[model samples]
Target: MSENVRAKAQETLALVDEVNAMVLSDPKAADAVTPLSQADANLGEEIRSRMDEIDMTDTQSIISFGSGAQTELQEISQAMLADVRNKDVGPAGDSLRSIVSTIRGFSVSELDVRRDRSWWEKLLGRAAPFAKFTAQYEKVQLQIDRVTEDLQKHEYTLLKDIKSLDLLYEKTLDFYDELALYIAAGTEKIKGLDEADIPAKEAEIAAAAEQDQVMKAQELRDLRAARDDLERRVHDLKLTRQVTMQSLPSIRLVQENDKSLVTKINSTLVNTVPLWETQLAQAVTIQRSAEAASAVREANDLTNELLTSNAKNLRDSNKVIRQEMERGVFDIEAVKQANADLIGTINESLQIADEGKAKRAKAEEELQKMEKDLRDTLASAKSRRDGVGDTSGTSVPKA
Candidate 1:
């Protein structure tokens, strides 16, 4: 894999180098504006004037624009981490679960005897789930509206950034074009001074060496000094060109980064957001189906269990009824208990009668005894009364 990647990289680099060579081979790279005057016209002044004409400020601004876009891309990626999701389907789950639970409220009566809820209760039950669904619909619609608004907002931002990048890309190209021209002109100007102008001036000085040595010496000094100054100016322009050349890759890097950001933002607006919404909607549908399936499955299981339980209960009831029906009207144990209770009652009544007769005999004896004592007492009282009468008569006389 690494080898394959390296091979592909090399192939791409080769194509890039070929294109670079072609772009570098501009037919007008060399300076042709300055005519060769040999000793008259000011070629150095022309080169310096052209160098001043190049506006580096605009170039720097274009590069900064691309860089700023890259920074925005970084910030947007961070924002997207909180924004985009596949699971923000909202409050439908509670409603779906409630509906499922209501469905599962089927009792054993539903399977065996009659219905559990009345017709009115069942009709009213339908109203609750519908209202829950209506509430969920409102909530989900609000979320959809929010998602749509966010998508539109992001779409606007991405479009604006894309246009700015387009402008920046164009400006960068213009900068490279101007830089190439400046570099070419500066290089040719220096070459002309070195190869043609300075040599001619020196040759003129040599040709006048014997005729006016002093004046020629002064002229020579002036020529060399002017040449050095021009060289310095041309060198400064060359350095400027080199600086921009280094900046080429830096500008492209920033442009590429911004392009990456634009791609991502576009995808979020155009594709990912819509796809997430579609999937979220499908998720709600699937959840509803799952809830319904689960509810009915539980109810079905309960019905089966209810039937099994009823069968077992009926078997137990039948066994109890059969046992009772097969039994005799009077068990032997019950008859024996009744006979023993009757004999015990007779014994208790005979014992009560004998005790009553003995009490009556005792009462008669007591009565006879009372009679004899009373007679004797009466006789004694009569004698005492007669005696008391005599004593009272005698006491009245004695006291």
Candidate 2:
């Protein structure tokens, strides 16, 4: 019985260590920003049901222990009476003396050999059968003390296991919450840039141009440039939205798997630990009987099976998380490609705008030069005609 309890304690501690490592290393909790899915909700409900079962099992086990303890006490009492009636008082007294001495070495103050010896002396002179019965009672009491100690230790270990699991669960939830908030805030920021900032800048530029305020050419250029930049930003924001939408499914899948994993851990903590306690308690109750060893073996086997099942579940969940993470990475790459395309488009448009502005300026300069040349030619022609006399002409003829 002691060996079984010790083994269970070690196993519980190992489980605690394993859980701590897993929680600390879990990347999904760190990265998953998506909301929980329907599958996640269903898994949570299933885990809750399993927890309810554990509670019911614990309750029933307590009732069973109470009834079983009572029955065992009566049976032990009957056996003591029979042994007293049939066996030699001297041999029973000697056996009890040895048990008391051993218990005393372990500081079992309740079963004081010295006090028992005095009581035995008195009963020996008066009644040998009663003395035999007293010895048997002392032996049973010692066994009860040992079993009680074992149960207390087991309970303590189980409580530790539950506490560790609860800590892990809280940490996992906190990480996910942080990730969700991060994603939400990013989405809101992009929306504001697209819907609010860009439109406001465009309006400001249009108003400035309409008033025709004698602003510096540089200032006008800056305003127009700011408007163009905002337009590009709006395009970028659209791409971001597209990428986020595309990634949502993968994110949701990862979140679902992560939630399932946490639920599994919770189920192990709530269900497995209590179940082990109950089974060990049952085994302890029968530890003085011929069936003690077999009871312990059965309990161990059941615990091993539960652990194996939990491990398999965790492995499957981990695989889903990895796959979803890979999908998320792919979605991110798609977003990068979209941004690259947007950049190329914006650059090409800017280049075309610059070329158009240059062409219009050159055309205006050429038109002004042609008008000046025509005016010069007309002025020269008039001067030459004025300078030439009305040659010969009319005046001489009139004379």
Candidate 3:
């Protein structure tokens, strides 16, 4: 073969290498992207249903919590406002104003809720919370609904882009292969013509009679240009495929509502809970201290009075002190129980969030495996084609 033919063959092989590299580097991404798209579709539905279910429950919880908080805030507000009117409880009400404002701010907007509860209602049945709890629960449900909708949008866009990248890579590979074949077949044909044993006179006449040499040469050069063009396409595809694959992995859905809701619940519990508990304790301690101080004062008066002449008033005062102590104990028990309920709700939210994270990870791993298998099959086929020479006269040489 002539040096030009050999050079073209090398160029053709280089193109095959470029194409193979583009296809092989991200086979898992190319092949697996299709199923990942479908998975994204399924995941959207699954997540929506789950969010709907969780939101229903969570909204009910939110409503319950919000109602209680609102009640406390309103009561505090009423007392302060009343004090402003009555001029008696004004200082006491003013003292509680900051707490009331904080509680009022904690209340979420009712309009933000998603109230579709057909299947969920049937599943949970009449076991649902009362009106107060339901109202509270619905508040949290709205936040979850917004998050799920955002997740669906994100997933749809990502899966579509990934599938497109996969198709682009496949086409790029095929183009490289076709162009390489064109070069290889052209080279073989030229080699045959060089080896042809024609008479010198016939060869000279044949060469002279062919006025189309320039056109033939032009066509060959065009083919070479085509091969080079395919190589560049394959190279760009490789880079695109890599970037696309990287983008795909992060497309897994994340619920900002899930994170924020859980965080808010925990943080609110952490900060407000201890303060409430301390206030209840302090109230009890102050009342007890006041009673003890009064008792000591009374005993001193009784001792001095007995030294002058009275046990009846002191006995009556002891009975009043016992009643107050019993009331304080009951209030403390109620506060503790409320704290426990809030903690339980926070824990449940965290568990659901963890399950969602795990599902995303599993889906990603399965997709990776699928793409890898496809690339391996393609590579093996190319290797076999390389081993076989073009003994079949139909095979054309590289242009």
> For every model shown, what is its TM-score relative to the native structure?
0.48, 0.21, 0.22
Over 4 Å off, model 2: 1-177, 180-399
Say which candidate scores most in TM-score. 1
lDDT against the true structure, per candidate, is 0.50, 0.46, 0.42
Write candidate 3's Cα lDDT for 1-399 as tens digits. 224433433443443333224323322534222221233565444323322321211324222211221244345436545643653222222323433443354333322223344587768763322332344434433433333333333333333333333444344444333323222232222233335512332344447546865655554454444434433443443454455455433321122222333233333333443454355345445544655776798999988989654466767787899878778645767888988988988898899889988998998888888888778766665665666563543343333
Off by over 4 Å in 3: 1-209, 248-399
Which pairs clash in model 1?
Answer: none
Candidate 1 similarity to native, TM-score? 0.48
Q: Give model 2 RMSD, 1 decimal.
A: 61.4
Q: Write the per-residue lDDT of candidate 1 for residues 1-399, one digit (tens) a residue.
A: 123433433343443333224222122222322333331345555435554443322433222221222344445435444443432433323333333343344221122111245588677874434334445544554554444444334433433444444444445444544444444444555566678866876777778758686776776576555545555544554454455445545645544554454444344434554554465456456556765777889999999999999999999999999999998999878999998998998988888888888888888898889998788766665666567576553432311
Ranking by TM-score: 1, 3, 2
Give the per-residue lDDT digits (tens) of candidate 2, residues 1-399: 245544554555555455335532233432343422322665444333322321211334222211221243345436545644653223222333443454344322322222334576676674343334345445645563454344334344334434433443344333333334333333333345457854665555667765553443445455445434433433443343344344444544443443444343334334544454454344334433424455677899999999999999999999999888878545877899999999999999999999999999999999999999778866665665655475632232211
Q: Could you tell me the TM-score of candidate 2?
A: 0.21
